[model samples]
Target: MNVLIITAHPEADSFNSYLAAKAARVFEKQGSVVNSVNLYSENFEPVEGKIFYPDRQDSVRFDALREQRHHWEKKILPDDVSRHIQLLINSDLLLLHFPFWWFGMPAILKGWMDRVFVYGGIYDSRQRHENGVMKGKRALLSVTAGAPENACGYNGRHGDMRLMLWSPIHALHYIGYSMLEPYLIHGVRGGLDGIAKKEQQKLLDEKVEDFENRLTNIHEWPIIPFNREDDFNEDKTLKPEAPEYSPFVRHDPDGWKKS
Candidate 1:
């Protein structure tokens, strides 16, 4: 198995980094070829703009999609973007590690997605969703958050994690990856004072082992449910005949959508 592990954390000695390293060891032990990258360390640019396109369709007015497609067809995409896209194409599984900051991924990683998942190169209207180029590949997100697990649950103080993480899941799904159940480690920033020190250490060890064991049995894990292209109508609404999965896209026969 080929694995691509990406961690988006600024701190080199962060728990996310530790977990990423552990993930590498696990994959290596299982004889899987691993390609690891750190977004912050790479100095990855997060904003998408005209700089990527040296030769634009219309120099006066910039169109991101147009330039992306143009550069892609001309085979002049930025080296970093091309390389990352190639990694996605070559790998069978993707292991994403990051801290849940401001209720979503850090801007740097989000920018990485913006650049790497080029509009014209990675997905087009016909090639997206079920028909994406990465149709058979798998992706798993391991998120670490400072909030306690209880506070992050449905109707909790931190809001429902499921809803919060839906965007990333759908993004990967849109790109044709079969997403696995996310591995969420809550209370990552538990107090560092004396009384909590030993417990934190124990929890850290346990989580590392858990992450490894989960990957060891990765094949047995079920993929997250998503409606296929056929499941939607010409209007892009879910067909009544299809089984509804996400609240994001559901069949509302009465026209009054349920929240």
Candidate 2:
């Protein structure tokens, strides 16, 4: 198995970086090829400029932009988004490690997604049918947050972590990948004392083992909810093991629609 690890922490010494390294090592030890990409370290540009224009369907201009896009996607820059996409294409498992910034991923990681997951790559509504290009791949999120679990609940202070993490989860699902339950290390700033760090490392080690076990037995694990089963006409036949539904859905026969 090939695993891609995308690390979004700006600081080299951050706990998020540590977990990413640990994940890479564990995956390597398990005999999986590991590819590590650090967004901030690569100085990746997150903006999509005039490449997306309103009334410009000219082939010449389009081709020019496409060439530029190809360069950005293919050239190995310190932070090229294409390199990560290539890794994603070749890998079986994707691990995203980041320090939660304001209840979401860092801007650099978001930028990487914006530039890399382009129209013809991860998403293309016109060409995408039932199974997307990324079908059958798996993703795991390992986030370090400054808030406690109690602060990250629905009625609690921080709101639901799922709410904060829905974008990437939905993006991956839309492209036909399965998602593993995220492993979160909450209160990173508050929970990193001597003993706490040791406990956290132990817990992370156990979770790493669990991650490996689940990969080895992926068919036995529960299927990810809210995938594009409708395209396969399996909506009626399939039932979600988890009660969670997609927040992006606009309508539902039941009263579960998000208002």
Q: Write the per-residue lDDT of candidate 2 for residues 167-231, one digit (tens) a residue.
A: 87766666667777677776666446788888777865675676556656644756446634452
Each prediction's number of clashing residue pairs: 0, 3
- Lowest lDDT sum, 10 consecutive residues, model 2, at 231-240
Residue-by-residue lDDT tens digits, candidate 1, 227-259: 887887899877779997766676665543334
Clashing pairs in 1: none
Worst 10 residues of 1 by lDDT: 250-259
How far is each candidate from the true structure, as Cα RMSD in Å?
Answer: 1.9, 5.7
Global lDDT of each candidate: 0.88, 0.69
Pairs of residues clashing in candidate 2? 42-78, 42-79, 151-158
Evaluated at residue 36, the lDDT of candidate 2 is 92
Best by TM-score: 1
